[model samples]
Each structure stands twice: as C-alpha cells, then as structure tokens.
Target: DVRECLARAGLLLEGAPVLYLSGYKGGQVNPAKGDFVFNCSAIYELMPTDVRLCQPAIFSGKVLSALGSIIAGIGRPMTDAMGTCGKAGQSVPSSGGGNMFLVIDENDEITIGGV
Candidate 1:
C-alpha cells in the first residue's frame, strides 16, 4: 500500500530502498513566529541500480503538515517523532514528533522559510 501511494506520487524507485527513515532527532523552534529549524535525516536504499543520491533539504512546517495530511487522507500510517530537549544546562525528554513523507515527483516543490 505504501508503495502504491509512492507510485501515485511518482516517488517509487525502480528498486526498493534498502533503508527508509522518517522524523527528526533534534531541532529548534520559534513559537512567536511559528518558525523552526530542525536536523532531520533520511537514508534510502538504491539497491541493484548502484546509484545513490544524497543532499540536504529544508522544508517548512506548513509544507510538511500538508504532506502529512495528504498521506493521512490516503490511509497511510505514520510514526510519531521523538526527541530530547536541553536548555539552560538542563536536559528534558520530549514526546512530540512530526509525520514524514517522501515526494519523488520532480514537479513536487516545497518552499522553505523565506527564500
């Protein structure tokens, strides 16, 4: 079912990825302006093809939310993100996490924070 969804979005690779990751480990956010900076990682497997693509990508919370909504509308299950927060020499555990989706369509574009 997940593969089908990816296929509809033009994200299904010719071969199955050896690995797939979703969610962030740590990040910062500005509640006043609803802005955030996060460190996220996703590793995909391009087995048999022998080609690997890696790059840094940034996406706004709005775009991420939209994608999550789209996935939910299609009945795909997503895992909740988890991380720990530290501030003022204190460490705190956090439970909130964001839904993640991989968009493979070349036409799928997301705008990050103001340019």
Candidate 2:
C-alpha cells in the first residue's frame, strides 16, 4: 500500500532523498478544561528510492514530506500515527478515534511499521 501510495504519488524518484516516520499517536485533549496532552511514537528513516527496488515499504507521510523535499525542499512532518479513544476519555467503552500529528527529523528513531 505504501509503495502503491508512493508510486501513485510519483515519488519513486531516483537520486531523490526521503524521510519516513511510522508510529502510533495517542492522547487526550480538553480545550474547555484547559488540558491537552498527547504522545507520538515515531519510526523514522531517510533514504533514496530506486523505483526498481522500491518495495511497498509501507511508508506514510501523506507524501507531504516527500513532495516537500522533492519540490519545495521542505520535508513535511509526519506520524501516520493513530490516536487514543474518546473525548476527554469520557466514554465508558474503550475505542480508538481522533487525529494527531507528529513530527520527527529524518533520522529520529522510535517507529511503528511493518505489517
């Protein structure tokens, strides 16, 4: 899927460098209560794509990072990460939902990848 994703995005460029971060992101936010906390589990790697040898790799960064690096020279931050459940942890049942963004340098360690 990540390969297909990159292939679709046309980011399999030779001589182009890339940074990838894969992981889990979870936390709680309560604006009204003035409380906000979250976590980022970042898996980071930077490399060049061979296109021929590029496997799915399952890399995710919305192509924002790749595109930014390739086109604008600004690698977008990423996490492809998921979040914890519920608003203010109010629900009785445990579930998963919400959105969180995590950023890491190209070489930062701490990843969540591989299917």
Candidate 3:
C-alpha cells in the first residue's frame, strides 16, 4: 500500500490523493502511465489541525469553499510551510482520520471540528 511505502520511507503523513494545486508543473505531478506514485520526499504536507464548523466545506485557502459543488472557483498558488518563513499549502501531518467533535447550538447551527 502507498501508506506502507511512505512509512518505510520515514514519511508518516496520512491522506491519499493529496491535492495538487498545479497538475503538471507541480513537483508532485504523477504520470498517467504509472499505477501509483511514491512521495517519500514530498516537500509539502497537510496543515497540522483544522476545524470546520460547516459541513461540505474545504478551508485550505484563506476563504472557505464548498466541496463537490459545481461552482467555478479560483485558488491561490501553493507554497512551502517549512521554509525559513512558513508558507501555506506545505503539508503537515493531518490531525487524524474522521471528525474530532460536533456541537449543535441553540440557534440550530451545526459546528464540526477536526484536525
């Protein structure tokens, strides 16, 4: 499995199919001819921990965007987070797999938290 391959390479990060801000020019570009790609030396990692109050929303960039929506959206350029100055889009270990917590307010708004 890719996870095992990564683990053997001393990479402990989780989550497969990590989003590629740039499909071709990007460093982690995967060729269509290959069945899988190993990223033992992936420079970017997922953010440490993130809590989403709303469902079906992705909070990767500055703004919150809907997930699996047909709306056309624009994204910012990816950066390295572990450089001399930390930048966004540079991967870090995800908090974990699954929702961390959920709360229902009196106003009926639902809140979700996850790493």
Poorest 10 consecutive residues of model 1 by lDDT? 105-114
Best by TM-score: 1
Residue lDDT tens for model 1, 41-97? 644444444535444344345334434434333334465646667788776776643
Model 3 C-alpha RMSD to native: 18.5
Clashes of each: 2, 2, 6
Question: Whole-model Cα lDDT per candidate?
Answer: 0.46, 0.38, 0.25
Tens-digit lDDT track of model 3 for 1-114: 323333444333444322211121212212343222222212222222321222222122111111222122223333333323113855544221222211111121211112
lDDT of 2: 0.38
Worst 10 residues of 3 by lDDT: 101-110
Stretches off by above 4 angstroms in model 2 are 1-4, 12-18, 30-38, 50-89, 92-115
Instruction: Between candidates 1 and 3, name the one with more favorable TM-score.
Output: 1
**Which pairs of residues collide in candidate 2?**
42-110, 43-111
Please provide, for model 2 over 1-115, each residue's C-alpha lDDT reduced to its tens digit, 9 standing for 90 to 100: 3443444555535565444434425544454643433343543333344322222233333333333333321234444435444657565444432223222334212222342
Best by lDDT: 1
